[model samples]
Target chain A: MTRLAVAGVGAISPAGVGVSTLAEATTLGRCVAAGPISETNVAVLKKIRRSAAITLYAATAVEEALRDCGVSGFADCALISGVTNGALNFSADFHHTLVTEAKETASPTLFSESVLNAPAGNASIIFNIRGPVYSIIGGQSIAIKALMLAATLIETRRAQRAIVVCAEERNELSSFCYSRFNPKAARVFSEGAGALLIEPVDERRPINPVELCTITGYAAYTIPGSPHLALQRAIDGALSMADLEAADIGVAVSDYKTATLFREIPTLSFSDCLGYAFCVSTMWNIILAAMACGGGCPVNPLFAAGLKKYAKHSEINHVIIYAAEEDGDASAIILSRVGASS
Target chain B: MGIITSHGVGVEANWEKIKAGESSVGEITTFDASPYRGRLGAEIRCDTSAPVSHLRAGRLDRASHLLICAVREALGVAGLIKPGIDVFLSLGTTLGGMLSGEAFHREVIEKGISRARISKTLDYLAHYQAVNLFKEFALTGDYTVFSDACASSANAIGHAFGLIASGRYDVAIAGGYDTMSEFTFAGFNSLMAITPEICRPFDKNRTGLVLGEGVGILILEELDHAMRRNARVYCEITGYGVASDAYHMTSPDPDGKGAANAMAMALKDSGFPDIGYINAHGTATKYNDLMEARAITKVFSSGNNGGVDIPVSSIKPMIGHLLGAAGAVEAILSIMALVEGWLPPNINYVTPDPDCNLNIVTVGREAKIRALLSNSFGFGGSNAALIFGECR
Candidate 1:
């Protein structure tokens, strides 16, 4: 088994650019409203806006993440981007153009960006990452899938390090479809990007115990017609891999309501503060879990109350991240502090 | 392995057509392509009137149709469709259901957004295809969708290979599928990457690539797992490697560094001193062929077999470029050649360019190959190489 470490992190949520900003906002229990992205801090690529907002957001987050890590060269890094809508803006634009204008007159740039892999490709170009690049498409569970792939890549030695980025952009078509599918759950939809740099854990180097998190195990399952069952199965699979029980988990982060499964475990949710960001939701939760383990709190007030109760019993060591999409796809990941493994 | 291509459906049908050196590229009849500069493409002939009994009626796109047909054939061959067996599915595609999405968009525009069925909009999602497979087959296993431009399926296979080889999954269904759509066609045409004539890869007079669509499915099982099940292993996937040029979005590096690195990585992973054949990512474009040729020369110029010439051929001419599915399709053909003792010729190779100075196989030749390598480089400089060999 290969032990992996989270080297650096970055985020481009509604709150702002850096992970610190997101953590600060989350600690205050502030919910940032979705709006147009600010370009002031981002290093815009040429004609990047012509692509999808997902791609732009991913590029921004990746740049910030790399900068935060103080790693310059990416020749050996692999990029695994988890996406839900992919290029929703481009898809909508292309469709709008095709519907209103002739097929021949549709913008090729929009069509190019409309493909599911456009954001990964654009990020690869921006970062000069030559190692294997893959775009894993799914619902909210995609972020966990990306983490699993990153761990696999590192474990297999296919890549020295992997940059896993999950991003989703709000658009009319997706918003409309979500509203039509589930009205009550529609208001939580938001748009953002989160990036994490993961690599094989090196014991030789001096590492911060707080910043250090090991991806013990991950699991994904598809259960038709019952997302709750799928989530349970994934959690079970992950727990088996980590050789831990639900009671041993210090913090459980998820977009879905996990009170039924992880009853006594302290649960935290970023969607409460960040809203539901599709693919970005689970990743945001993961960043917060890492911060919390590193002695930082980004939980909402209600979740913070639960965290306070758990904090008295034990120091934050193990964090379990779970996410299930409406499509019945579910994924779970277990992250534990380096020296705090049970 | 199971395959559905423009030449026809099934592995044998496509193999026969490719062996005959026949070009499947023709006028685009799926839709009105007269408005585009390159109107020719290789399209699978599916009767829309007859629906697949298992799949949802009226909502299946051409890509999904091809995928379902291919998966059924593959599972039938593998005999792994029975319940209680856990499978990890990794599918690769550039556009999942753009055809259906396009239709939905047209309907929404003509009728109204409110009139547009939510099911139709859901069909537009890339993962919707995987979801359909999960429900249709009752696959209670992990699944992932890979969309890395033209290298999509190749990367999918690579990832799947890793999953199995790492003992993560006992079995996996890895392949790629894509449909030729007006959206993709117009985009390629605008980029001037589509050839008006049949694509002549590596030929001196080659212009550009011709669009094609199909699906290729490979049922991967661990050696011990297959042996225990008495499964007939067609070929062993020894190694796979993926890399990016980091050069440009749509163009390959002039030095072919990324392509060469991928091949090198695969070779190292395979622990094979030399490979007998290379299925080139020969799009027949000006830059791809040149870069791929250079990459090949860099890797195999000084072979361990004492300067032996490795046979190389591009099946893109016969099948056109399948885009996202091209990698898996070409990889299947390469494995077929390794098993059948013949080289798939590069048809339409009238003249050779000096830039591509390798030993290009213009005519089919008989050869007992031990190992073969297949290359696929896609838009955004994504490059992948897969190695397959006779099962030891």
Candidate 2:
């Protein structure tokens, strides 16, 4: 089993540009409405002006994460980005132009960014991550898969470190489709980007450092089976990988309604305030989980209160993050505070 | 392993056509191609009479149809159609259901938004193909969808190889597929990436690449598991390496360092002094062929046999470039070549450029190759190389 260290975290969410802003907003029990990242906020990267929102969000979050980690360059770092619709706005525009207008009128720039891997490719170009870059497409669980791939890459010595980013950009087409399918949940549509810097765990590194959280295990399961059963299996697999038990998990982070599974543990839902930004939801959960384990405030006040209430009496060493999609896909990862006993 | 290409709907069919040096590129029939500059493509000739048996059978897009058929063939060959097995699925695609999405959008434009179906719109997402497979086969294990342009499926296969090599899963069904769509065709045409005539890889007069549609699937099983079940072992995936150029979004590095690094990484991981054959990612584009040739020469210049005679060829001229499915299909063809002692030719090779100075296989050559390398580079500067060795 390869143990990976969460070295840094960054997010571009409804709360604003930084993770601290998100955490502060959650602490104050405020929900920032989802909107596009302003042009001024991303003007630092002038090249991004011609790029799509997904690329902009990813570049911003990745830059912040690199700075937060105090890393000067990422020449040897691998990138694994999870995207749901990629650049949907650009694609819709290009497609609409092709269908309604003349085929020759399709913007070449938009077509280039329309591909699903464009964001990951642009991120690699902008961040100077020359190592292997992979673009995974799925719903919420894709972020967990990205983390798993990152850990695997590090364990196999493919790279010394990895940057995993998940970004989503909401568009009218997507909003309309979702509303048509499930009107009740359409109001919660939002857009954001989240990133994590993970490196292999080293015994010589300082323990319990402020910039460290250890990801001990990860598990993913699909369905044709029951959703509950899939979730249980994933959780059990993660626990076994971590060599821990259900009772050992002190704080749980998930967008799923997991009250039945973790009845006694403090469960935090980042999506409660951030809305269901499918690609960013799970990564946000990981960030929030790390914060909770590090004794920092979360973006949700109720979750913050839960963390405080649980930590006052217990050590809150182990935090398990769970993410499930309506399609019956589930993923779980176990993170422990540095210096915590296995 | 199983494959379905424009040549036909089976591995043997494609191999036969490939051995005959027959080109599958023809006029596009899926849609009206009159408006596009490059009207030629390798489209799958689907039989409308025999339909796939599923709830959304008829509504499935070309990509999904190709994938489902290929998976069925792969599972049949591997004899693992039953459920309750821990078989992971990793699929790669570029367009997914864009054809269906385009049709739906056109309907929305003509009729109204209320008439557009949510299901059709949902199909546009790249992961929907994987979801369809999950439901179709009742796959309960982990699944991933890769959309890294032309390198997508190769990355999927590489990930599967890693998972099995790491002993995470005993079996994995991995491959890639994409269909010819007007969206992609127009995009490539607009970018002038599509060749108006036949694709000619490594040819001095080659213009560009020809888009194709097909699917390839491989059922990768652990050595012990396959032996216990007495399964047919095609070849062992010995090594995989992926890297980025970090240069340009669409163009490759001129010096070919990025591509060479990926090949070197794969070679190092495999610990193979020399490979018997190489399936080059010769996309027929001027820059791609030149860079790939340089990369190949740079990595294999000091060959184990004291000569840089590693026979290399690209099957793109025969089957056209399948984009996302190119890697997986070419990989399958490479494995077939290894087993059958046949070196697939780079058809339509007339004049060779001085830059691509390596030995190019112009005709079918019989050689018993122990190991082979397949390279796939895509639009995002993503590059992946895989080495397959004779399992015996």
Candidate 3:
């Protein structure tokens, strides 16, 4: 098991303002969702209205992540994020207000956030991480990919610790996007973010050690034939990472988007509790797996799949999370739970 | 990477025809440029006859088609593919598929622009023309679409290089693509960046730029990966340097200090004091050409040409300005020059500016070129320079 640790977290989601608010809401199964409202012209009002979009969710999550890490500065750390649609969620009302509200002498710092990498930029500014900041937008598999990247950062020893954040904000416009494609399903549009503070576990440091969940294995593939093939590959790859088999295990977290649910077999239990979350579903699954480990829930491996419409069933000694996009790109990461007493 | 020239779609076909020095610029076919000042532009030949398989797959957005054609050719030439290869697809594009959105908007406007029409248009905000390209490839890798105006793709390539060099990803596909959109065409027309006739870079009587569109992709891998896999190496990306002017959005720094700084940084990063050839970002604008020439002179001048006397050329006369895609395309051209040992001519260098005195490769010439540098400076004072040399 890799000795990677989640050192800190920050978040902004529909459930409320910060990570604490989101965690409290999640405990009650409260989703930050509202009926679609008519588009508004008030920029601030629009931000208030559609602020559930992943971009804003990501922004809030980023701020919280920095704060939770006690990172008052990004002066030395590299900033990297998994952004699915970037600032595309920011409405024209926001831009218009930004353009109109700027007096002749606009503050230089105001529009700096307008950059697509603003989430990382803001985090960098807040934390004073003067190193490198990177932002990449993969479809729904962005979160898993981010975790993979964070691991790579640790493996390379670029920094002792790095911040890896995955967030999606609610956008009123996204409804049209979903309606055009998956019209039958109730819009599972929820704006939320999940941020993890990742660091190397150092036995030398005299600090309260966070319980570690090791990332065992991961794989990503884009197939034109069977979208399900992606999930199968991830399952096989993740299991082999630990040199384990399908029956060795415990619980699972599946980050499969619901849009692809109709295309799969009806065995997974997600239909009962976790409906569909495009990207956040991955984090949701991880949260569930963590909960299962905490409450001694029966070990049922989470099987997540996307548009590739494939199912991945893993039997592991520890919890595992599966994440995939609809169009055939899928990734599976095995997490080894530590500290059974906890 | 992929090459989308008017003569043909793939590399072999383009190489066969480019030797003739044929001007691919002609009348605009995608849209009516009749009322426009610069009616001439480059267009890619689409092979619709080949059936595109896969559900919701074959429908290629204008930008996507260009990307597919180009990437396929590049991959074929590279002669290798691997699973578990993390990809960073970086592209610089603007107003992608907005032409389609405009078509949708026009129908609504004809019926009278209503609240419904307004919402529909705003929704297009999320559907940038480039996303269609990503969907077409089914690329599940981490990616980013940069919209830094003109110098967008250059920044994309530069950033991709940084990511790879910094050990973020072992392999990456970085490039740029832009199709002429009515929105961009009209906007540039309004801004007076479009020249009436052929663009004359660095010429005394040079006018503005002519707009063109195509896709360019560079399949970049870590140096070790290419060697181990025995992938055909076109050129090694030696140095990439980026700087912001914070000077102006539309205009470049007139003093050329920012441009000079970027080139110096690139050369310094490459650790190469000697530069062989340059693919100048000579857009032929009155100020751009003069400014770029001054910048080049300051960096390359050993005493006369500054300090380093090197041959320089701009292929914009052949392809016109591809805007967001220019950096990637120019970088491709630079790599090709290193590999092919031939310098493409500047084409329309009938007269030269007294202020710009470097050896412009006006005529296609053969040379033992190894290391080359290319420049792409975009709006908002964003400047990027990339140096590629024969893979050592």
Candidate 4:
């Protein structure tokens, strides 16, 4: 069982920048679009960002995460990011300008920022990170793939610490694709970014008593037509790896309807607050779950027909975050409060 | 191994073309390219996978079509079809489904955004192509897509190796795929990175790279699991390393520090036994080839003149730069070199400079290679190096 410690977390959500804004969104049940917030800041710093909003949002979130963790400069660190469409507006607009106008009139800057991994690349450039930098695109499981790769990097000793970022930028083509593919789940799509700083939990040394949280277990897989079965398998694998049971979990942050499989355990979610920002939604869920463990504040989670409110808590030592899609994509992660467990 | 490049549709066909030193680059016919300065590209004239498929070839993007055929060929050859064996899919792509995106954008440009057919744009997203792969084949395993420009597939394969090493999954499929798009063509042309002259690498008068498209995929199964099932193993993947330059988004660090670190790390990860050949990421650009030479000299210094004089070669001159798919394409070619006892020739070479002081394989050579190293660099300072050898 490989475990990684969460050192710090950052957010650039609809409410504002900072994890406090994410917590406030849960308290107020708010989901807003904060594209211009990151765009303005990133564009003021660099000219290329004006053409690419995803890079701007990702850099803004990564900056907060680096600062939150007290990491000013990079030495032996890696950056891994996840995105849904990766500056979709630029790609769409570039193609529009190329075909409508002459091919020679194409803007070089727009074409440079239109690639899929521009967000990760821009973040590495802004932060001066010299380690392994890459981005993952996992449809609805983008966050899952990013975190999984971070674990791989740490386990293989590729980097001592890693910053995992997941961002989304909404455009007309994105909205159209969402409406056509999964109409029921695509209620309201927004734009934002979520980041987490993770490091290897050194078991050789004494355990840090005040450690915020440790990712005990994680699993990602797919099932052809069985959505519920997919969710169950991921949760089962994660729990088994974490050496815990479903009943041992105090709370569960989930977005899938099949997550109801774990009944009567104070189930809740932050989608109402973060909206359906694809990968960002899952990243926010994980961050909020970490905050609830040791941040000295009880995050007020939003409830729905399936997603429940912050009901009575028993111990709140272990929180499991689960997300799934009807297209058979399911991923689950278990977070253990080190202070509480000790 | 499975591949669908301009040279051919399968591994054997591509290997024969590459082994014969036949360049596949020609004039672009899929779309009008006469307006651009660099009208030449490695476009596939005979697309067997796209023009006919059970996947409704008309609706799918060319990238998706290539990926579908490649995956089918790989899985079928490995006998993991139908009731698919439990496996993990790790894929890589840069401008995925950009041609489909152009089609949708053309509709938007001509009519209006609201009038554009939503179904036509469904495969425009990178993840949509991955999802279509799952739906087309009766695959049941999860997947992760890497998008680190030209190094996308190298990073994907590296992460897949880590998964197997950690005992998480027994079987994994790793590779990359891309299709020629006018958007990318114009972008490269706007940067003047595309050479109007013949595509060449590591030459004094070499112009630049010629953009191409294709898919290169390999199935990675655990040694014990494969032996238990009596699987036919071609070669073994020893190790891989990933690094970022962080100097420039469009260009690499002139000093080649990051590239050197990636190569050193990969060699270190593989225990540094002995390297026989290096498949260089020698893009014909003036800056790229020079930086790569400096990077190679930084790692394997030849001042002592007693080191393992390794031979270095670049296949880009023959196949054109496949961008995201270049890593896996080169990896597949390298493994063939290791197993088939023949090295793929780096054709179109004219002269060399004193700066790039290394053994450059100008023509095809036959040798019993013990181990091979392949490198890939991307537009955004992304760098990766992979090592392969016979099954240990």
TM-score-based ranking: 2, 1, 4, 3
Model 3 agreement with the true structure over B354-385: per-residue lDDT tens digits: 78877888788888877889998765455678
Judged by TM-score relative to the true structure, which candidate is superior, 2 or 4? 2
| Ranking of all predicted structures according to DockQ, beginning with the best and ending with the worst | 2, 4, 1, 3
lDDT of 1 by residue, B200-240 (tens): 98999999999888889999999998999899888899988
Candidate 1: where are CA atoms >4 Å away? A44-50, A102-106, A203-210, A297-304, A309-314, B48-55, B303-308
Best by lDDT: 2
Ranking by lDDT: 2, 1, 4, 3
Once fitted onto the true fold, the runs of candidate 2 whose alpha carbons sit more than 4 angstroms away are: A39-44, A203-209, A296-304, A307-313, B48-54, B303-307
Off by over 4 Å in 4: A31-51, A180-186, A203-211, A298-312, A340-342, B50-55, B81-84, B304-308
After superposition on all CA atoms, what RMSD does each candidate show versus the true structure?
A: 2.3, 2.2, 8.2, 2.8
Model 2 DockQ vs. reference? 0.74
DockQ for every model comes to: 0.72, 0.74, 0.08, 0.72
The predicted structure with the larger lDDT, 1 or 2, is 2
DockQ-best of 1 and 2: 2
Per-residue alpha-carbon lDDT of model 2 for B1-392, expressed as tens digits? 88888898888989988877888889999888888777899887855222455437866766677787888888889997566787789888887888888887777777778887667877778898888787777777989989888999999999998899899999999999888888898888888888888898889998999988889999999999899988889888988888899888888887888788889999998986359999999999999999998888888986664335889899998888998899999999999999999999999899988878878899998998999999999987988899999996
lDDT of 2 by residue, A162-264 (tens): 9999999888777888877777664577787898888877731353346457898789998754677788889999999998988888878887775699877
Clashing pairs in 2: A26-A299, A26-A300
